[model samples]
Target: MRISRLVILGGFLTALLPVALLAVGYTLKTRALMLDTTLEQNELFSKEAALYIDKVLVDHRNVLQFTAQALGADALDPAQASPVLARLRAAFPLFDRILVAPPSGVTAFAVPELADNGQRVAGANISDRAYFQTVLRTNTAYIDPDVLLGRTSGAPVTIIAAPVPGPNGGVSAVLVGTIDLDSLTQLIGRLHLGASGHAVAVTREGVTVAHPNARLVQQRFNFSGTPVWQYLRGADQGRIASYVDEENTTRFAAFATVPATGWKLWLSQQHADVDAEFYQLLASSSLWPLGALVVGILLSVLLARMIARPIETLHATARDIAAGDLDRRAPEEGPQELVSLAVAINAMAQTLQALVVKERGVRAQIESAVTEYGRFAERVADGDFSAQVMVDNAGDLERLGHALNAMSRSLGLLVSEIKLATAQLGSATAEILAATSQQAAATTEEAAAVRQMAASVHELRQAGESVSRRTQAVLDMAQKTEVVAETGLHSVEETIRSAEQGRQRLETLAERVMGFSERTHEIAEINAAVAELAEKSNLLAVNAGIEAAKAGEAGRGFAVVATEVKELAEQSKAATAQVRRIIADIQRSAQAAVIAAEQYAKASDAGVSTSRQSGTSISTLAARVTEASQAARQNLVAAEQQQAGIEQIALAVDNIEASSAQTVSATAQVEQSARSLHDLAQTLDDIIGRVSVRPGAERRVS
Candidate 1:
């Protein structure tokens, strides 16, 4: 059930159940009491009707006995009884006749003259009459049943009979006064029966003696088998009973037995009529309770609203909160306890809202910090580490920012150290490579000198065996010339190859340096792009901060986020600056290396040309030694001239030796520089390795 309906029903039950029970009990009690009172009233009416009939009979009998007494036994005959009877009948108009009957069972005299059944009363026989028989048996005045017919009128009458006195003190005749049946009916009709209420009289034989309806008077109203009859049969008077009458209407009746005639007088009323007053009283009394129920229902509705409205408000507010609208709150407008409950709910909502806002702020800050740190990491991967995370006044994030700033400073210092060491190492490696080229050239020159000295010795040995006397000087000169030429050829020809190879290697190195410079330029361009992005990010953060401020308290969380974004932008700016600086250094180093390589190439070309000339001079010296062997005296003279050429070759060889020696010395110095460069490179590698930098593949989250 909905809360409103449930509350209404509950309130109604609480207020109405007991009242309903009490109303039922009152109705039952009132019904019983009213019925009892009605029955009593009916019985009283019956008794009053019985008393009226008895009085009329007693009065009639008294009058007849008095008149008979006035007449005496001396005046009982027709002549003496006539005037007395006339006066008696005149005094009581209800009487149909006044008869004087004897033991002969004949009526001797009757007032209004003769009143026998269409017969003269002077000699009328009444011996068989019940009243006459009753008088003779009882020797007293008696009232007969109203069912007996009058002699003259032939109508039912009450027979009031009494024995006439005898001077001998024995009964001689009976005096009878027949009262009209209508008199009894009129007497009974005078009873206190309201509208729809009536009285009826029945004889002991079940014959209707008197009724308010004349037609029912002499008719057979057989109440014998009924509750009225059963109760009144043994009752002398005032009997009460209930039964369904001839009309199929349930009735309550009371009966009283007439003492004079053994007849029962009944007063009957319909059950509905009997209860009319009770029903009126019942209807009137219900207003109070009905009014109370109406008032209760109204109050119950109000109470139901009081209880349910707050709960409904709370429920609605909770739904809104769950849906992420944390601003709604319950009302505090119900009962005291309910108001307190509403207050509690509102407090809970506010607390939860605050916590949620705080959580959102924290989450945004963390996410912004993570993304900014990721960009910072990217720069660090590209060997730029001069950036620093900006700190804020926020508790945890401020502390985190401080830690990050410290780490960035430390990394920047470490990278600076590494870059300086690498630069020095690169310079040393370049010198070492140059010196190795020069030393290789000098080794070739020495190896060629050893070959030349061996060839010259073989030639001199040939001269000593053939032109032993004149070829001595020629042999000496030839050996010197071959030695110088061979020395120069070895140094010059191999140096040509060494210089070319060195030149090629230097060209390669310069090209590689240029490539590295290009890469640096790319890195610089990337950094410039990052710097531009950071500037845009900074502007966005500023706009966000402004919006957050406009949003007031609701935007506190966003304010934090904006601050974090701005800090990230600043960090990017610092990193981009660092990258640009490093790129400039790389460009300068590449240009210097290119200049050194071009100078080395020119020197290598000069060394190759000088070596070709030395090879030609050695060939000429070999030809002159052959001449000295053919013409021994002419060969001696040509050998002297070859000596001059040998001197010139020696001078050229000496110049080549000096150049080679300088190259070798330079090579040795280059080797030391290379060793130093290798050590510096190892230091740079160790330094770079000290802080592990995962490439872009490693994504960072808060």
Candidate 2:
């Protein structure tokens, strides 16, 4: 069962058991005490009944004594005797008759009723009866046996006798009082001790005197035959007897002896009557104890349930705690101990709930930190180092984030430095490339200038070649002119020799000339033709001079040619003159011919020297031009090399620029990562600040 049920049941049982035991104990004790009390009450009732009966008997004896003393008076008159008898009968109702017996054995003067009937016998010696005999013998009052007497009428009676002494100290008469047994029996019948309880008067000899039943009165009671009589006879005087009666009915009997009458008074009660009050009392007492026991048990159960309710709630909370519901709590209301337990349990639950919440928060913080770290790592791996995370106020997490941020910042700074270096290197390389390009342009210009110089030198060499060829042609023309002059001189000399031979032939031919003079006239005509030719030559010379003047400087060389022709003609004329003279001076003209030939030879020599000098100058000019062309080719090769070197440097600068760009990209990524880390540190600080901890909260980590 659940703890609550168990606790409640245990408490109920605990409260109920002792109360039930006490109630049962009380019931049992009460029953025993009530039984004893019932018996005692019955005994007391029996004693009261005995005393009532004894009082009646004593009253009867006092009447008898007073009557005896009245009868003993000394007046002794017949007139008084009748009045006294009437007075005695009226005074004592228990008396059947009041009779005076004289000492001389004479009856008293009888009443008229006894005289008319003659019922009285005087001096009859009646002392044989116990009351009469005792009164006469002892001079005291006496009680009679049970008898039937006829005074007014015959009835069973008990007689009381007392001695009347005569005036001189002698007995005068006896006064007898008779009591009706039937009347006593009626009184006994009216006396009620209890339901089924009766009063009885018995003689000392066990004869029934007065009884509730008239038939039993004045009868000899067989003491051994009836249980009530036997119990009364065996019982001590003034003691009660409890036994079954002759009717087989249970009874309580009490017996007392009357001192004056020598009679026994008994009060008899049925046991059912004596025990009736006890039965009702027992029922009430029994019910009281039982009701008390039931009420005690019910109250115990209710009280137990009330006490256990808080504990039960506490136990349920404990179960919830075991099931991992750390927030469960119990109401702290109950008995002192149970309330304390509930309070403690609630405190524990609150503590546990706080702990669980703290643990979960810590775990969440750790996971967040781990996730941020992972993101940082991913950014780094992707070369996007500029990513950063904000840190909250999360104590240790904040510190760790700050540390990561610092590291990232350092890395970013390093990347920035490298990027700066890369940019600087790129800029320097670009400047170098620009300078190299300028150098290449200058070299190209130098090469172009050298090429122009080479072309100029080649043109100069061609010009030199042309000049040499033109000089050679001039020398050849001069030589041809000298040869022509020599030929003209030879023709003149031959004409002179022919003239000398003709003169000899003319002497021979003077006759031939006279004959020839006729022929000479023909010949002279021929001579005249020759002379005309001479005249024509002179005209030609004159014409040549005029033409030279018309030609001016341009016709001078032509005029000289014309002059040479005229000279040849003139030489012919001169030859004619020389022929005329040669006839006479042939011998002298030989020397003159030799001198002209010498002058012509000298002029040829000078022409040869001038041609040689021109050839030498032309060769020197060709050599100088060939050297200048070689220098221009060398300059072209150097310019081509410089241009190639400049291009190579430009390509290297481009590569450096590309490297610088990549470095800048990397530096940007590093900056981004540093910023991200710084943000993460700030987030961690904020989280730490927001978290609440109780006073005296212990730190699990630094």
Candidate 3:
């Protein structure tokens, strides 16, 4: 926690932090690049594998198509077809069998003699087979969607069917070659993927065409619902995806479609395996940063010691100075900043030592001056004015000694003067006492007269206060009334505004209603036109019915239509009459409502006029009351001023009476003090004779 340690820590972090961060960033970036490269490589490999598989399938299809083409019209004849089929099967041992089926979809010939169940494949009905049906329909080469169990070998195989052309140019028979799927399984198994990596081929339907696990191939395992199938099914070209397999192991896989067979080829590697290899490379690259961190720690310790050495030296010097060793000075050395600090500390110590010495000299001077001053004070207390303070070279103390010597001389003269003044004061006091007694009697008589006048003024002051209170009450009432009148005026104005708004709204409503009535009348006119049309239509229908009756059986439909038209016309006329009656009723109601609104508007106008008059009258009353209040307030102010003047006079009279009483008592005291003063002056003169102002001097009072 010391600054040195903190600085060392800061330096260490500065050296190590960036290197550590670079190492971490490099590791993470390398891992991302490595993973990306791995995924790309897997995708490329999958595409290559898919192409290889497609080539293999194409080779088989080519042989089947060549045989079918060569057979021409002889494909239906076992004599010519059997030789070619046997040759094709022998040349490619990957095929389980070579068979030929006629257009009837029945297998007419087969290279293999017997099936795995001992049934003859030649006689078997091939009509129900999907590949035979496809060949018969499109007349093109087709590969089966899934691997099937071979009828001859009882092994998983896929069929490739090619059409045989008839003599007339239509497909006459199908040449089918069954290829064993084990060759594809072995081909993918031999792929040089890393440990825990393998290639797979699945049918478009998600059935396993070829897999490293032979059991899955034999069982025709379905991957239709698996994540691997979901990725493969949608991929038109090579792409990489990650998924967890049925074994719960996460894997990165690349999928590509085999163009020839529409099967998907997947090249996959386990995630854990890839990560392990990546981390091994990362660990090997991390040692440089580790070494850097160790070197940083060593350098930081060296730097900390360099920084702390000079500071420690300064610290020791300061400690000694605090313990009273003022002679010690800090050594000025090391960095410039430390050197400056040491110089400042040494200067502070020197200045403190000099101040201590100067303070001691001053203290000694003060002690000597105080001793001399104490002796002089004793001589003065004994009434000896002949001695003087003689201490020197003491600031303030020397000035004090001089002042004491002058005060002793002045005191000797002051005592003689005080004795003479005391006798004169006694004589003057007796005359002053007689004069003060006469003046006090006259002041007492004047105070009585002033007091009597104050009482009468006080009565008038009370009456003035009563009038002031009444005026203030009237003023307050007038202000309140004025406020109330203003409130009423505002209310009246608001009412008038509301009534005007109501009247305007009513006029708008009446205008709208009148417009509605005019619209209704227009509707009536339209209804009358409709009624006239209905009557004309009815007349035309009746005439048409009459003509139909004359025309006989051919006009029966026309007659029936005419009767229906006549009935519709009659009903329309009745409906128009009812609409006209409703419109008339609405018009009447609207007119009555308009009259009522007009009447209410007039009544509102009358009420508003009355409220306006009342507001005006109240305002006038408030103004008159305010004027009366103002006049009364003026009278009250004048009375209050007179009252204040009288009260001041009363206070002055009371003070005069108290002063006169004190003067009379003081005169009697002065008469007794005069006699005491004469005795005290004689005693002071006798005491002054005992003190030696000038060495054995004596005084005599005459």
> What TM-score, over all chains together, does every model reach?
0.47, 0.39, 0.50
The order of the candidates by TM-score, greatest first, is 3, 1, 2
Q: What's the alpha carbon RMSD for model 1?
A: 59.7
lDDT of 2: 0.60
The TM-score, computed over Cα atoms with residue i paired to residue i, of candidate 3 is 0.50
> Which residue segments of model 2 deviate by more than 4 Å?
1-59, 72-80, 102-125, 145-155, 186-191, 228-231, 234-241, 279-298, 307-702
Clash list (residue pairs), candidate 3: none
Q: How many backbone clashes does candidate 1 have?
A: 2
Q: Identify the runs in model 1 with alpha carbons over 4 angstroms from their true place.
A: 1-25, 114-119, 237-241, 282-290, 301-313, 327-334, 343-702
Arrange candidates, best lDDT first: 3, 1, 2
- Score candidate 2 by TM-score against the native: 0.39
Between candidates 1 and 2, the TM-score winner: 1
lDDT of 2 by residue, 1-702 (tens): 755466556656665677678767765676556545544654565455556655765676777677667756632455766687677677766565556666654455543335224565333445556667677778887767555454434446777767777777656787766677876777667767567877777776667777666666534454446666655564545434467765677666656665555566666676576457656765675666556656666775676677666666777889998899876778777688888888888788888878887899879767866876776666545544444556765677778767766666566566556554554555555555555555555555555555555555555555555554554454454445445544554554455455455444434423432342233234334544676697787788879889898989988987887787777777666555544443334333434444544454455445445545544554455455445445544544555555455556555554555555555555555555545555555554454434332222111222
Model 2 vs truth, CA RMSD = 79.3
Off by over 4 Å in 3: 1-8, 76-83, 115-119, 151-155, 238-241, 358-702
